[model samples]
Target: MSGVYLIGAGATPVAEHYGRSLADLASEATRAAFAGLPEFAAHRVGALYVANALGDRLAAQGHLGAYLSAAVGLRGVPAVRVEAAGASGGVAIQQAVQAIAAGAAEIVAVLGAEKVTDQLDDAVEAALALASDAETEALHGLTLTAQWAMLMRRYMHEHGYGPEAFAPFPVNAHANAAKNPLALYRFPINADKYRKAALVASPLNMLDCSSVADGAACVVLASERVAREVAAEGVPLVRLAGVAVATDTPALALRADPLDLAAARASAHIALGRAHLGLSDVDVFELTDPHGIAAALALEAMGYYEPGAAPRHAADGAITPTGRTPIATAGGYKARGDVAGASGVYQIVELLRQLRGEAGPTQVDGARVALAQCLGGVGATAATCVLVAER
Candidate 1:
């Protein structure tokens, strides 16, 4: 297998692009990604991978790989779409890396785009519900927020805590987002605001949930030889050290422990191992936080904290960029806006910024190794990747 390196990354700000189609958003990102590389050749792009979850339901479009490829002027390349619910972007990255490693493609383009805000409120809810168990959960009207709220309630009961304990997750995310130009919610919030926020579901307030947004993110992966050529031209190379994906039972009711997040743990463990590193070696983490409780569960499951203690870490400000385990450095899903399939790519783009020392205000000083993990359908699927800056 050959090594793969990220040579370019780009993203559109997470917001309501009222008149932009999915292809338009993706094309903009792709153009930005190629803008920095003077040697970029469209014909050299051997394959195109597009990640999206709701294009058909929300945008009335399908075959996004072909659509986006042509939109970006890569019409004849082997193009395909990757869908794994919320983990679609990360899984797309995983596939791109594999293609480069296996010599199937020397240069691959991965684009994750989602148009989520264009649909009606009820239609958006229905499309999101497709990520959950259709027969058992969605059929019974178990919306995504409700499932997360149930988990939060159970977590509070088991840990003897209250809803306020999870406030730190959103507070920290918003604070970080305040410094990120591409973030949707660029204002900080206090614990008081969180406590007083309107409830979307019991124990999970509106502030605790990620907002739906429309956006796209893109990254270019190259073989070791191509990466060296790019680096020779002064482009900073960020190595794709490791990547892995894992899955769990689709139905939450079937899990032995609803909050375990076994898939996250498994993917993180494998990715870290492949990177020849440990938890302590990771300088930054970009884990999914669609809901505050989800962040807590992910932190614990990824071994950043003891089970049931992640909330405490958050409350104590341990997850801040200057803390022991800095997470959500780019505002994360809570405040950055969750564009569903595009969120994972957003995380990777943020990590690349951190690695390149380009994260203006949200930069993690001396950050060398970064980990990004995205979860799909509650905790049913996970994709994890470890990246290292060239020394």
Candidate 2:
């Protein structure tokens, strides 16, 4: 398999907009993504890969592959729709890797898009149902939030980690979003606001949840040979070092621990091992943070903390953008809005910006190696990727 490089990426300015479907937003941003790059105007795009979680449910934009292909004017190329629940985008990239490695394609365009605001109520309910085991968990009347709430209680009882330890997670994301021009929730959320916010499910508050949003992002990938032929010096080329996916038990209650993200930890270990890098070698981190607790659990499962101590690390400001390790500098799903399948790809897009030193105000200084992790439905499924700047 040939090495691949992420040559370009573009995202719609994150905002709350009405009556827009995910495909529409994706097409709009993808067109702009290619149009803005004069250097790649003549380059041949061999395939189009789209990561969409909600296909016909929220906006009824069915047949995303054909729709986006025609919309982006990349006719006659193979178009693939990638979906792994919330980790759809990351999995889409994983497919792109195999395509490149197998000589099936040299250039792939990956897009992650979601329209959650059109039918906010249904979207919320549908997203929650993703936490279920479908045959079992869904029949048992479980929503993602409900599962997390129960898991949170279990973690609290098992490890003495309370709601207070998780408070800083969302608060930090909101504060970080305040600095991001494209973040949906730009206002600051302090400890006072955290204490007073209405509880959606006991420990999880209204502020703890992500807002409904409609947006899209796209990235262009080319073979290593093509990157050397086209890229400029200042524009750092990020090579996809490794990618891995793992799935745990479907039912949260049936897993090793409802609060533990076994799949995420396993996927990260595999990806980092393949990349020949360790936890300490990653310079930037971006996670699919649908809730504050999800972020804490992923960090702990990924060896960032010792089991129940993730909350304490987050509370001590160890996970903030300016802290020792930054997770979700673009505010994650908590501030960036959870767009289901799009969340994982969006995290990769943001990390590309950080690696290229093009993140503007949110840039992580001196970042070289970057890791992005996305968990699907209470850690039942997960995808992890490690990328490094091409020297």
Candidate 3:
């Protein structure tokens, strides 16, 4: 298989862009990506892949791959849309890597875009609920917040934790976001504020949840041969060392152990093994953080910490950029803002920034290897990727 390298990446500020359409947001992000590679030509893109979760329902837009292709001035390229709930962006990049590895494409552009905040609150909630099992979870009146709350409740009950134990995740995320200009929430929070926040669901407060926002992120991938050419032109390269996707039962109730997050575990195991690296070798992690409990569960599932110990790790500040694992280096979905499908791509972009030593105050010193994981529908689906900075 041909090696795939990320040549350039970009993202719009994670904020409500009520004036921009989804296609417009996508085009802007694409333009930003191309700007990083002055030697690369946009017209030379061989394929385009778009990842989005609710463009159809939120903006009445569909056929995003072709639409974004044309909007970005890469008309007539073979294009397709990929959707796997929140994992759409990571899966789209996986597909692009596969295409390059199969010798089917020399250069590809991956865009993850969403226009969620334009809709009413109830409408946005309904659109997000589609990611869950409609018949068993959504139709039965299980909102995403409620499901996460249940997970938090179970974690607390089983581990003897309190709501305050999970506060560090959001607190740390907000502190990191204060240094990230592209993040939506720029202010830092304290444990007291988190405890006083209003409850969205039992055991889950407003601060514990990621807010839905409008944003887009893009990355350009190329075959090894093309990557060498770009590198010769002075562009730094980041190799896609490993990529994998895994799935589990969609209904949370059907799983034998709801806290296992089996899909995340499997995907991370496969991805890390493919890279010939272990969790200890990773310099940074960009895991899903749509909810505080979700972040803790992902940490445990990814082997960063033992099960039921992630909350304690969080409280110890072990996941901050200066700590042992250094997760969510760009504020993650929590404080950086959750753009649903766009989040996975945003994570990749943040990783690329960290690898390039461009993360400003949030930069992980001497970061060389990074892992990014995106989950869909409460771990029903997961996509994991390992990246190594080219020396």
- Listed in order, each prediction's TM-score against the native is 0.98, 0.95, 0.98
> Model 1, which residues run further than 4 Å from truth?
none
Clashes of each: 0, 0, 0
Candidate 3, superposed: residue stretches over 4 Å from native:
none
Q: Residue 262 CA error for candidate 1 (Å)?
A: 0.5
Off by over 4 Å in 2: 35-43, 232-234
lDDT of 1 by residue, 1-391 (tens): 3388999999999998988888788988988788787566455899999999889999888888888899878898999999999999889999999999889998999998999877877888889888999999999998888999999999999999999999988998999999998899999999999999999989899899998799999998899998898888889989999999999987899999998999999999999998898999999999889788999999899888998899898888888988777887889999999989888899989999999999888788899999999988897889999999997
Per-residue accuracy of model 3 over 1-391 as CA lDDT, tens digit each: 3389999999999998988888788889999998978555576788998999888999788888788889888889999999999999889989999999998988999999999977898898888888889999999888888888999999999999999999999998999998888899999999999999999988999999999899999999999998988898888889999999999988899999999999999999998898888989899999889778998999899888899999888888888999888887889899999989989999999999999999988899999999999999899899999999988
Residue pairs with colliding backbones in model 3 are none
Clashing pairs in 2: none
Give the alpha carbon lDDT tens digit for every residue of 140-190 in model 2. Answer: 667777777787778888988667667888888887788877778888888
State the lDDT at 277 in candidate 1: 88
lDDT of 1 at 283: 93
